[model samples]
Target: MAAKQYKAIGEEAWKNNVEKVNAELFIFTYGSLVVQLVKDFEDYGAVNKQLDKMGYNIGVRLIDDILARTGIDKCADFHTTAEVVAKVGFRVFLNIAPAIANWSADAKEFSLILEDNPLNDFCELPPKAVQEGLWYSNVLCGVIRGALEMMQMQTEVWFVHDVLRGDDVSEIRVKLVKILDEEVPVGDE
Candidate 1:
């Protein structure tokens, strides 16, 4: 249940348990999806929204996989949640665990700093897309949001710095809105 434990579990899972994939193929597939979304929507904002929605759906299911793989209990707190997300969640899936930083005094917010993003590999945005406020990797934000929602933690995630947007590093800012309580079914309650 500790961060260190999660790190070791992530290493074990990534090395031995998880099925491998061709990074290039995965990247190309994702790239193609983004391109198709752009073509379909013809609007950068809409493309971002679609991508986020797709990611959210993925996240909702992905959490189940993570839980099954790790067999871990609910996160003790947001800080621990951040650690698990950085060390285990990202590592198992992306093979990258971003550095957690810029914590607010309230401890309700933090930033995940990625010096290198596999998603951005060989990806360069067009000037028009940049000008139109398109977040090429907006799916990641939705992923975090959806994953946390399933964990009963409502968090807002957004990209504050993106290498695609010419920032030095890709940073995702996560703010805890509140913890969602378990809900009873209409008839059961």
Candidate 2:
């Protein structure tokens, strides 16, 4: 019942806020960016880190857009937050709804299973990049980390599986480290 409501909200919000783009163009742009990153860093780890940083920055700003579009209030728990992220956040931004799975016993961690990734559309890692252990979608992890940070949830987000690397399912594992307390600056007080 709750899932259905969230889906409806996501669909309506996406319809109202999202700007439709050609999937091919989006794929081409992302591919070019990856190519440039590879050329600049040479090391796959460094490239992935840079991409994650880029996504983090984007996520920070994206949260504002999401809040404005969805008009969703503060979530009462991490579980609710995760549902919003999976249903509304990704759906509105990427037109894909990922499944939240693999919950921890304490509910402090879970996995997001991405069945369809826009960034992975028409994407194939070059043999050299694969050999160097590059994570092609590292940015997604960073985005989740940054967005959660802004929401006052300290979290570690990382990719655990990638279909591009021959995994049957692409998954991101997010661990809630702690909840951040809102602090007022001394000067402001």
Candidate 3:
């Protein structure tokens, strides 16, 4: 399907099918979750890892929701995969379709430029956390990684820039490692 068609599907689903929630409640809840993670781990890096793991679990299930909600077929190429993810997946989930940009010459990597991240809404990392390399939205990288893994696209996703980290825009870099045609169970392999 074309990117525009995906966008239309996302818009329609978000408008009519999905249940609405209080945006502030969601944001505050996420903020408190981060706070609790930081306190529990006492290490910014560990907090980030925990957030990523949580998001990965969410994404593993989220892909199923996207497939059921939009009924789009698997993307045939990396370019189309990028488009469908930007136009459909993010939109249906966050109501914000980040801009896809900075494609590599090989087209194996690209950046998702989030002009506005709901997660970063009203979030500011402290100086110590910033110095310790806390990616305020690291969860998103895990989400993308897990979601694409389900799509048979092995990818490395991470935050290259974060608005909460004082960058002009939040950027998530996604690099396609390889496409998996088949897999072995770990012990069998």
Candidate 4:
């Protein structure tokens, strides 16, 4: 189910709404939403799950917008999907300066290790960060899993490293997992 739509506005119109744009800003503010929304909703335990689902919902919608923007056809396989992610998705959709060469393909999936993570490097999380639990990039992870699922591929999002600590560099890894099993349509009248 979709979230409540507040004041429908077009993409072009959105640019003028500074507060709304800042309200949905993801790069430097992913955690803030999770923290605030959890308390606002009064549900902390389900935060991660909600984040994942929300991310997937974003992917489902943004993938179509992205494909339309780049004029690229749907990728047919995992490799092609990964290529699209690096060349088109990352570059156009996220406006990321991806070197594109450092990305690697593994047995189960491809990994894009950004030499500079804009989200993490954009701002420093306070030492002894007060928020409870892990500060994972739930939005990005959700987008990837959601977009891939739209392309009919199953995926899992996991965090391999965090730069919150004094690690010289942080690493974030995502791997494509298995296809979801088909379920019979059950009816409740």
RMSD of each: 1.4, 1.5, 2.4, 8.8
Q: Best candidate, TM-score-wise? A: 1
Which residue runs of candidate 3 sit more than 4 Å off their true CA positions?
182-189
Model 4, C-alpha of 96: deviation from truth (Å): 0.8
Where in model 2 is the C-alpha error above 4 Å?
185-189
Clashes of each: 0, 0, 0, 0
What lDDT does the true structure give each of the candidates?
0.90, 0.88, 0.90, 0.57
Q: Model 2: per-residue lDDT, tens digit, 33-109?
A: 98999889989999989989998998888888888887888778988888988998889878889999999999999
Q: Which wins on lDDT, candidate 2 or candidate 3? A: 3
Relative to the unseen true structure, what is the Cα RMSD of model 2? 1.5
Worst 10 residues of 4 by lDDT: 1-10
Candidate 4 pairs with clashing backbones? none
- Provide the TM-score for each candidate, comma-separated: 0.95, 0.94, 0.94, 0.65
**TM-score of model number 1:** 0.95
lDDT for model 1 comes to: 0.90
- In candidate 4, which residue ranges exceed 4 Å CA deviation? 1-31, 38-46, 97-106, 126-133, 179-189
Q: Roughly what TM-score does model 2 have, to 2 decimal places?
A: 0.94
CA shift of 61, model 3, Å: 0.2
